[model samples]
Structures are given as C-alpha cells and as structure tokens.
Target: MKILFHVLVSSILLVSCGSSKQLNENKNSLTKEINKIYQENVFNGFAVSIVDEKGTLYQQGYGFADISTKKEYTNNTIQNIASVSKTLVGVALQKAQELGKINLDDPIEKYLDFNVSNPNFPNEKITIRQLSNHTSSIVDNEFYLSKNYYLKSNQDLTNVKLNFDEEQVFNPSDMKISLQKFLKNTLEKNGKWNKDSFSKNAPGTIYEYSNIGTTLAAYIVEKATGETFQNFTKKNILQPLKMDQSGWTFQDVDFSKFSKLYESPTTLLPFYEMVTYPDGGFITSVNDLSKFLSELIKGYNGNGKILSKESYKEYFHPQLSATNFIERNTQNPYNESYNVGNFIGYGYTGFIGHTGGDPGVLSMMFFDPKTNIGRIMILNTNFSNKKGNDAFYGIWNILEKYQDKLIK
Candidate 1:
C-alpha cells in the first residue's frame, strides 16, 4: 500500500512540473514573437505587457526610447498615452456620481459657468451621460480655432512660406481654448447649438466619438469635485493604482527618464501641450500601466485603495455602438466596438480598451473582465502617414497572436 501511494504521488508531481514547464515555454514563445514584430516594424520606442489570471507573465521593452540619443527603452520610460486617458477620466466621473456629488443625467448648465453661441441644439439639458457617450452635439472645431489663433498671432508671417495649405493650420493652444470656450458657451446658451449642427441621433442614441465630449466630461468632473482635472485624476485614479509614473501634465517630470516624443521618419518634436487632457493627454509607462490594468481587471471598487467595481462596470458597459466611421479610423483595427468609456470586443471576453495616437505617440490598453487578463502596448513615434498606420497594425497583430492566451 505504501509503495502504491508513493507511485501515485510521484506521478501527480511530474504532471504539475510538466504543466509549469509548458507555461514558461509558452510565455517565452510569446516574448520572442513580439520581439520579432518590433524588430521588423522599425518602431522607434515600444513597450508591451501581458498579464494573465495569476499575475504578469510577460513584460518587455524594445528599441530606443529616444532615437537620437539611442537611449534604451525601459519599463519606467513614460510615453504619452493619448485617448487611453479617457478611461481614467471616465472612472473619475463615475466615482463622483457614486459620491452623490453629481448625477449622470445632470445637465452641463448645472455644473459649468460658460455660454454657448450656436443656436441649433434644443433643450438646455445636455446630460452627463450624453457627454460620456459622445452623443452631446458638441462640434469639435479645433482646426478652425488653430487657424484663427495662428493667423492672428502670426499676422506678419503671412509672407513666410507655409507647409500645409494656408487654410489648414494646427494650433495646439487654440484648440484647447476653443474646447473650453465651447463648453462654457454651451452652458451659457442653455444647450442651444444648431439643431442640425448637433448629431441627429438623440442624446446617447449612437456613438460619434468626439474628443469634445470627453473634454466636457472632464470639465464636469472638475466643477463637481471643486478640483483641477489633473489633481482629481491623480488623487482618484493614479494614486490609488500606484501608477507613480503617470501624469496629465509634463511640468515636473524628469525629462531624462521620460521617453522623448518623436515626430516620425527621424525628426523629434517636443511634446505638444494638450488642453484636452481628459481626452488624450496623459503620460505613463508600461510597468505602471500594467498595475492600473491589473486593478481594472480585478474590478476595483474604489473601496480601500481602488475604484469601485460598480463604476468600473459602468465604464466598460456598451452604452452605445460606436459609429462605423470612427471605428474604421481608430488606431487599432481590432478595436471595432465602443462602450461608454471603453471599446468592446467581438468575443465574450468583456470590454477591450481603446488606443490613442497623436504627432509623437501611439498607445493601447485592453483588459478582459471575465478572465482578468490584460495587455498594453505603447510606442513613441508620429509615423508621418501610412508608416504610423503600419506600425500600429504590426502592434495589433502581435496582440492578436496572443489574444487567446492573454485573454484566458
């Protein structure tokens, strides 16, 4: 009897060891496959993280964080994670709602102190839900604001040669001011924009994917909390997640550690200031972001240290279907669906997050609630045209290859 029991115990131990070996082998293969894609794609700076149900299985950084300086990419190097910042803001709004500080259905006029000039929209009530879903009829006139501000500031430079069409200008500062003014104006006008000027779809009817909507949401968070948006996010989101490396502003960040923002093809541009930090203007590293995703996957409930599970669910719920046009234009083709604050996946893996891109940055973060698995990929480079598109595709392909394992 004793001999038989020993044999059985040995057999069980052997099987367990074999399974562990297989897990490690699979993880190594995933790392190799991702590295191959990084090598082939010529991505200037990139970081990828894959965490399973147990814990982080693989996290790696490849290529240079700064091409000119040849600085190696590290887990701590911060990259601007454009639209991914929205997920954080969404959580903040939900928290405020739960605290009885605001209501999702509250009108913008209730919280904001500005006046809108457009006369199309009816009913002075633009609800918080509408802003969160991008169903608010806010016209994003960043280009117009940029042009007007530039021409007004550079009146004497009219004779100076121009790169884009004289009519096409990109003014970062003016874009921010325009959004703030528009939000303030919308409140003052009692939510009266051109009827047709707003989307025909009823509020929260369909997703239009407007950065303006997100900015309004941020403004609401600030007004309700009586705190600056940046401070609110840091206190409510980043600090709780222990995401020490993330920040909405670039003021005190150590440039030596921060990944240098690159402007594609070889030129490097300093990070452009974004007025709409709520939409797409936060910076973080893969290591810190992995921690954030872990909390999200665990459905943190803002209890002791994390966001409320209820708020997390509300953010990931498919409030409305994102417009096809917006989906097609997204940085990740795999991100074909949209939720309230996130993008839903085709499978039953729950919600997959969105990606963000700008002149010198591209970022993606996705988490599966059911499986408690998540992945994040961030690259620094403003690939001029198709190059950026191709690089993003390469990253998506890498993520897709491991989707089953990552989402499991």
Candidate 2:
C-alpha cells in the first residue's frame, strides 16, 4: 500500500510539471507570433493584455512610446483610453446604486441643477436607464468636436498642424472649463454651445450615441453621491481594485509615464484634454487595465468585490432590443453599438465590452462570458486605412488564438 501511494504521487507531480512546461512554451510562442505582427508598423505604440477571472494570463507592450526619445512602450506605459473609459462609469453607477444613492429608472432631471429636455419632445422624460443604454435620443452634435478639446497648458503649439478634416482642433489650454458648465451649455435648452444636440426621436425611443449624455450621467452620480465624479470613482472603483496607476485627470497619475500619442508613425500629437472627460478620458497603463478587466470577469462570474453580485448582473444585462436600433451592425463582430448595458456595450457577436477612438487613440476591451476570458488593446496611434485596421485586428486575433492555452 505504501509503495502504491508513493508511485501515485510521483505520477501526479510528473503530469503537473509537464503541463506547466507546455503553458510556458505556449506563452513564448504567442509572444513570437504577436511580435511578427508588430513589425508591420501600423501603430506607434500599443499594449495588449489577456486575462481570465483569476488574473492576467498575459500582458505586454510593443514599439515606441516616444520615438524621438527612444522610449520603448511597456506594460506600464499610460495613455487615455477614449471611450473604453465609459465602462468605469457603468461600474460607478452600480456602486452608487448599491449604496442606495440613486436608481436607474429615475428621471435624470431629478438630480440635475439645470434643465435638459429634448427640444423636439420637451415633456418626454429621459431616465438614467435610457442614457446608459444609448436610447436617450441625445446625439453628439458638431460642437462635440469643435468645442470640447483643449491643448494641454504646457504644450507649445508652434509647429503643430491641426487636422481640421478630422475635426482634431485643439483649443488653447486656458479655455478648458468645468464639466458641469460644458454639459449644461451643450445640453440645456437654448444654452450656449447648444446645436443639434438632440435627435428628432423622443427620449428612450431610439439609439443615438451621445458623449454629452454620458457625461451628464456621470454628473448625476455626483449629485446623488455628494461627491466629485473623479473622487467618487477613485474611491469606489480605483481604490477598491487597487488600480493605482489609473486616473480620470492628468493630476492623478505620473505624467512622466504617459505615452506620447501619434497621428502617424512619424507625426506626433500635442497633449490635450476634453471638457466632457467622463465620456472618454481615462488615463491608465495596460497593467492597471488588466487588473480592472480581471475584476470585471470575476464580477461576471458572481465573485466580484467592488459591487454586489446583483449589481454586476444589472451592469451586464442587455438593455436594448431589436427595435431600438434602426440598423444593427451584424458584420462587425466587435461593434459595441449593437447593444448596451449600463455604460458598457455588447458586440454583434455577443462579446461584452466597449471600443473607443479619439484623436491619436484607439482602444478595445472585451470578454467572452462563456470562457470567462478577456482581451484588451490600447494603441497610441490612430488607424483609418485598411492596412492599419487589418494589423490591429491581427494582434487581437493572435491573442484570441492563444488565450485558451494560457487559461488555467
């Protein structure tokens, strides 16, 4: 009996060692495959992370964070992750609800100090749920591009060529104003900076992506929780998850670690900020985002810590139906506009996460519910042409191919 037990233990140990060896070998193979694609040079600097509910399976960065300085991008390199930042707003809303501060069904006007009714349907009440699902009928107008962006206070605009065609205009840094003032002016009835900010449809009747509407929802969180949006999120989301390297504004992070954004492999963009930051501005490293994604996976699995499991369920619940979209994106498997839950999005092919693009930035973060595995990509350069698009998806596809092997 003693001899049999010894043999059994030895067999288990041998199998375990073999499996570990195979996993490490697979990781190396994944790195080599990804590195090959990186040679295409479609983006200046980018980071990719693969994570499971337990933790990160793999995280890496490639290329130059600063080409002139010869600074290599690493997992700790930080950049603003455009609209992917909206997911944190969703999480923040759920946390506030868990604390009994607000309800999703409440009319947004209840907590607002200013009026914001659709000009076409003044009496139709817009609910918080509508904003979360992109059914509020609030549209980002031309002013959204023309007025929201401002250059960093320190940037010297001596030789920076503003791309008007792309609506990449950066106002002088001193013109940067408060979020409330910006939203109130853009969203209020006949307020300054207001244009065609509302669609013809009634509130909660159609899908219209509204960055202003999202910022308004974040403002509502401030009113209900009696906290600044930045502080509230830092305390409830960042602190709880230990995302020390992420922040809503420039002041909260180590600016030295921030990556310089690119218009092309050779053209650099001046640092800038948006007045309606809640809509897209989130500064973070791939390492920090990997931690956040892992928590989201855990939340989906009903073992999360930041918010109750019930809140997580609500956070992931699909809120839009077929009628909500006039034309749903069926071809693009990664299109987040197909559906929305809270502030996060559901892709056409059932991926849950969000995608964001801004001046010199592109970001995508999604997780498969069935597999409980997630992937994230953040690029410092913009991609509009087919070659860049293909290369972007190429890295994502390679990660997908290897995620299963790394899943333990």
Candidate 3:
C-alpha cells in the first residue's frame, strides 16, 4: 500500500512539471509570432493587447516611438489615439445618464446656447443618443475646415497674397476659436441660427457622421459636470482605471516626454491643435490603453466598479442599422457601415473599433466583444494617395493575419 501511494504522488508531480513547461513554450511562441509580424510590416510603432474573458493575456509594445532618437516604444510612449477617444467620451456620457446628471433622450438645445440651423434636415430636436450614435444631422461644421478651404481655394496665390488680399483669413493657433466664432458669426449674419438651422433633423432619421455631434457631447459633459471636459474625464475615467499617462490636451501633458509627431521618411510634422478634443484628440500610451481595454472587456471593471454592466451593454449595443451601403474612394479602402459612433466589424474576425487619420497620423483600435480580444495600430505616416485606401486596408490585413493569435 505504501509503495502504491508513493508511485501515484510521483506521477502527479511529473504531470505538473510537464504542464508548466508547455505553458512557457506557448507564451514564448506567441511573442515570437508577434515580433515576426512587426518586422514584416515595417510598422514604425505599435502596441497590442490580448485579453481573455477574465483578464489580459498579453500586452506588448513594438518598434520605435521616435526613430531618429532611436527611442524604443514603451508601454508609456504616448500617441494620439484619435477617434478611439470617442469611445471614451461615449462611456462618460453613459455614466452621466446613470448618475441622473443628464438624459440621453434630452434635446441638445436644452444644454447649448448656440443655435444649429439646416432647413433641409427633418429633425428639430437633436438628442444625446443621436449625437452619440452619429445620427444627428447637424450640419458638418464647415468652420472646422476653413483653413483647408482657404488653402485649397487659393492654391495658386502666394501665402502673403492669399492672407492679405483675400477677405477670409486663417491662423492655425486660433483655429478652434476661429471655428467657434465663424459658426456663431455665420449663424447670426445669415439669420440661419434658429430652429430651421439649429434643429435640422428630427433626432434620429439619417446617419451622417458629424464631428460637431461629438463636440456637442464635450460641451454637454462640461455643462452637466460643472467641470472642464478634461478634468471630468481625469477624475472619473482615467483615475479609476489608473491610466496615468492619458490627457485631453497638451497643457495637461509633459511636453518633453511626449513623442514628437512624425511623417514618412522621418520628417517631423507641425503639431496642429485638434479643435475638437472630444471627438478625436486624447493621447495615451499602449500600456494604459491595454488597461482601459481590459477594464472595458470586463464590463467597465470586473465587478462593475467604474460603469455598471448595464451601462456598458448599452454603450456597445449597435444603435443604428445601415439603411443602405455607402461607398467612397478615399486614402483608405473600406466599405464601412457605421452604427452609433463606432465602425462595426470591418476587418477579419468582425473586430469593432474606430480608425482615424488627419495630416500625419493614422490609427486603428479594435476589440472583439465575444472573445474580449483587442488590437491597436498607430502610424505617423499619412500614406498619401489620391484616395486613402491603402492605409486602412493595409492595417486591416495586418490585423487579420494575426487574428488567430490575437483573438483565439
């Protein structure tokens, strides 16, 4: 009997050792595969995170944050996350609803002093839900593109002639202030700021993506919280998640530590201030973002600590359906169908996330709801083509190739 008991114990010990070795080998192989993908893609910098239903399985950063200085990309190396910031804003808006600070169904006019005018639109009342879902038909703020408009219109004229002789003028630093002023001025000057213009669509009729919709969200958050948008986010979302490196603006950042924006061929691009920080402006590192994703996967914290499970569910639920397919030939090739401030299931594995590009940056963040897997890619190069098709498709293909390792 004693001999038999000893034999059983020895067998159990051998099996345990074998299992440990297998686990280590699997982890090493996964890392090797990820590195291989990075090398093959020539991705300047990227951070990937894989989280299971329970928690994070892998979190790693690859390539250089600044190639010129040879600064290796660390988990803390901040990059402008672009429209992924919208997801964060959406969550905050939902939180406000939970707290009874605001109602999603409330008309935006109740919270704003400025009037939105568009006679062609059907809706007079624009709700928070519509804005969050990008169903709000508010005129796309033309002021946002005034500089682009002036530059394109006066392409033949010298800079001095364009600015001095032309009736319209633009200053990059004052762009945001100018945009707000222009909108206000145009509305007043044209007598178009009333219900006809202010309330264009009937809340939820058409699906037109609007940066103004998100800017309204930021404005509402500020009004409801009695705090600046940045402070409220920091106090509520960032602090709770322990995402120490994220911020809404440069003033809130450590300028020296921030990664210098770069373009292809390693040219540094001028840092233009994002007029609408709520829409596509916050910056963060992959390490902190991984933490954010992990929390989101667990339904805003494993135990519903930050946002209740119901709130999270509501946030991720598809709010709009494609009445029809829309096609565009842009720098990136995509047949994207939008539903409520998100790009749903574009690439392989039907990963849900947003992609953003402006000037010298391109970014993507996708997280699978069923599998709790997530991937993010941020590139400094603009990949300029008449149509920006290559930039989007290229990144999508790269993500698809790694789907097995990332998702499963």
lDDT of candidates 1 onward, in order: 0.64, 0.90, 0.60
Q: Pick the candidate with the highest lDDT.
A: 2
Which candidate leads in TM-score? Answer: 2
Ranking 1 against 3 by lDDT, winner: 1
In what order do the candidates fall by lDDT, top score first?
Answer: 2, 1, 3
Worst 10 residues of 1 by lDDT: 147-156
Per-model C-alpha RMSD: 5.7, 1.4, 6.4
Model 2 lDDT tens row, 94-146: 99889999999999989999998988998899999899888898889887888
Better of 2 and 3 by TM-score: 2
Distance from true location, Cα of 386 in model 1, Å: 5.8
Total backbone clashes of model 2? 0
Which ten contiguous residues of candidate 3 have the minimum total lDDT? 150-159
lDDT of 2 at 39: 89
